[model samples]
Target: MERAISASDANQRFSELLREVAEGESFTVMSRGRAVARVLPVDRAREQRSIQHLLKFVAALPVRHAGNWSRDELYE
Candidate 1:
């Protein structure tokens, strides 16, 4: 579960909070008692990008680059 902290507290403990986030802890930064932002591990962000890249890779089909094969050649 994500930990919750007030915006002010987040500001005060920003460095430590960043360390915690880097270690895989998540947080909900609250403003006026309402959640305003979330902090997540960097790995999660990388994973999201990798997943998106993989999805695009599969969706594009014919997994090959143009270094040795041209696009038109794929149909031939």
Candidate 2:
């Protein structure tokens, strides 16, 4: 569960908040007693793997052909 913190408090302790987040603590920033934003640490390994998968998928796509028919042509 994320800890809730008021906006003013978050602003006042931004550096400390970042340190906590880096240590695996997530937070929900509130404005007017309402949740406004979330602060969480990124999973670098997962993020890097996701980017690698995307790059590989894009690289494997077939190149376009000059005589290729559009989807409309297939429907017709």
Work out the TM-score per prediction: 0.58, 0.69
Candidate 1 per-residue lDDT over residues 4-75, each given as its tens digit? 999999999999999999888999999998999999876777899999999999998976765777778978
lDDT of each: 0.91, 0.96
**C-alpha RMSD for every candidate:** 7.7, 7.3
Candidate 2 has a TM-score of: 0.69
Cα deviation of 28 in candidate 2 (Å)? 0.4
| Tens digit per residue, CA lDDT, model 2, 1-76 | 6899999999999999999999999999999989999999999999999999999999999998779789999899
